[model samples]
Target: MFLKFLTFTIAIGGSALGGPIDPFGSSAARVLTQLPEKTWLESIAVRRNGDILATSLFYSSNIFTVTQPSVHAHNTAKILASVPEVNSLLGITEVPGSYDEEAFFFVGGNFTSLTTFSTTVGSFKGFKLTFPRNGNPTVQKVSDLAPFSSFPNSVTAIPQAPGSVLVADSFVGAIGRLDLLTGQYDPRAFAFDDMAVPKGAKLPIGISAMRMKGSYLYYGNPSTQSIYKVKVDSKGYLVKGAQPSLVANISSVAPGLDDFIFDPQGNILLATNSPENAIVHVDVRTGRSKRIIGGPTDPLMPDSTCLAFGRGILDTNTFYVSTGRNISDPTTSARIVAVDASLLNYY
Candidate 1:
């Protein structure tokens, strides 16, 4: 039964723009694996062990893990558990805590909080799955952030504050904090509209994805199709110098960029549903951007949703892209792609 979900696909050799160029040396872009047509790969995180944990976009109900994929075979797929069927699950991130290793995922729709069982009232919520290094993994409700969010999307663990994570909501247009230990969230802390935003297509959903760099927490604003960064203190509080500022915009880069990952060099790359790029790199320092894949070079990577760097020394310099294009027929072309960053001048 499980084997049916596994798709042994082709070794894709293409790019996202211009002509076919080797983005990953020998393999520019290959279809590593495929998901169900109705489902979409949303957010991804590289585990300490080099594995990947991913969440679904639209209506995919399962959270799964994938080992490093290769041309020799497809991604080894395994569904850890099934979430609510309401298509609430959106953003996901891994928490590498000393006491416990786990993955936290968000779900927002009619649900009020993150619960393993059904409830009469529904809203914004999320789950916490603890995967013990030596024992079996367990998935449970982390918190219901309805009071703090209208539609929660992505979440990032606060390294300085144990059992605490920063969460952003699309519809509410605010950022809040989720206390993992108590399964609750503080009042919404920041608002996007308060900042000076540039003119562009606002993805109705507002802010979606986020990541941390030293003492700063960077998040993606789907509304303006731009990335922004703010400073936070050691305890995850917004410092006095912390002001929401634009990092870069996707107005000219792609139709719109979704979840992005940081290259080892501190530069950033984003995924898009537009034909302009499946993967585009942005120099955070200068705010200059370049397309690594997607314009006419590789049609195979339409609607690239999320991306993450390969963990560990074995897959260093390797970046993986997850695509779920053709929303009309999502599964037929949805795939996980790889780009070799081993040979690049990011600095």
Candidate 2:
């Protein structure tokens, strides 16, 4: 989903400090590249070699690549691939066991219009992309998921089940499983009332961002303004009796949440609370959260959408974030920023 629901704002409170925390020496957030105006950068994934793959929503639905994002000179993102027929690309995740080559799976769909946040209902599809060492990258359609899904927003790999990933179907309010090798898709693989959008929401967004940690899946529910998690079996199905538990309540920080990435130790969850235009760190153990970077009035990362950690040793402490071009204004441009995560003391 895009910024159509951005008009619904939240009151800034709780542990959400409304000022920028400049712990990275002088600059609080470093802008690596800026896209053209009206581009909404949706989801992000980091390659094994530290390249960043970011998907853009609206018009072209282009996936861009940023190599050597740590460097500050002339670091503009270049187009890598564009999913045809769809106007937007939402969720993207790397295949866990692809050791010989870098492989990824992504979801795309057509919307009612460029400015509308609703999808065309039956226009969703999934694709697989592979980047080999010596040749050009290739992308192929893997599944036609529109029949069983309404809106697929985010994706995460289930390492226990190789070649299988769980897709967050936002409008359907469920987490689905897609098998890349067998072309099998189950739209109701995991569903709970907690994942549903509240009876009357400005936007019918349900499950947005999702990440798998060990045998559990952590996700954000924008409509509920909360984060929740549940245990899953080896096959990526929700455990028979496992109930979703509260991870945190972020209603005070932002009206909704978008996408998030887990810290290296898995103890912290860094999330993009959009519209409110802020990013926060949630402690998984205590459900305590604090605004670490950007804010409602902060120009650093306006309309922040998705986040990902750098892949290399030197840049592992640094994470990259993408912002949506302010949908209400035509002059605003989307951006990709590098944030230093070393200042976060999980203890």
- Candidate 1 per-residue lDDT over residues 283-323, each given as its tens digit: 89888887766664566676677888887676676777776
Candidate 2, position 182, lDDT: 65
What local lDDT score does residue 61 receive in model 2, on the 0 to 100 scale?
71
By TM-score, how accurate is candidate 2?
0.88
Best by lDDT: 2
Top TM-score hit: 2
Model 2 Cα displacement at 143 (Å)?
0.4
Global CA lDDT of candidate 1, please? 0.63
Per-residue error for 2 in candidate 1, Å, reads 34
The segments of candidate 1 whose C-alpha lies over 4 angstroms from its true place after superposition are: 1-26, 70-72, 99-122, 194-202, 275-277, 330-333, 343-347
Encode model 2's per-residue lDDT on 69-173: one tens digit a residue.
Answer: 665444667777766667888888988654567788888888766554767877888877777776777777787774857779999887777778888998899
Show model 2 residue runs off by greater than 4 Å: 1-26, 344-347
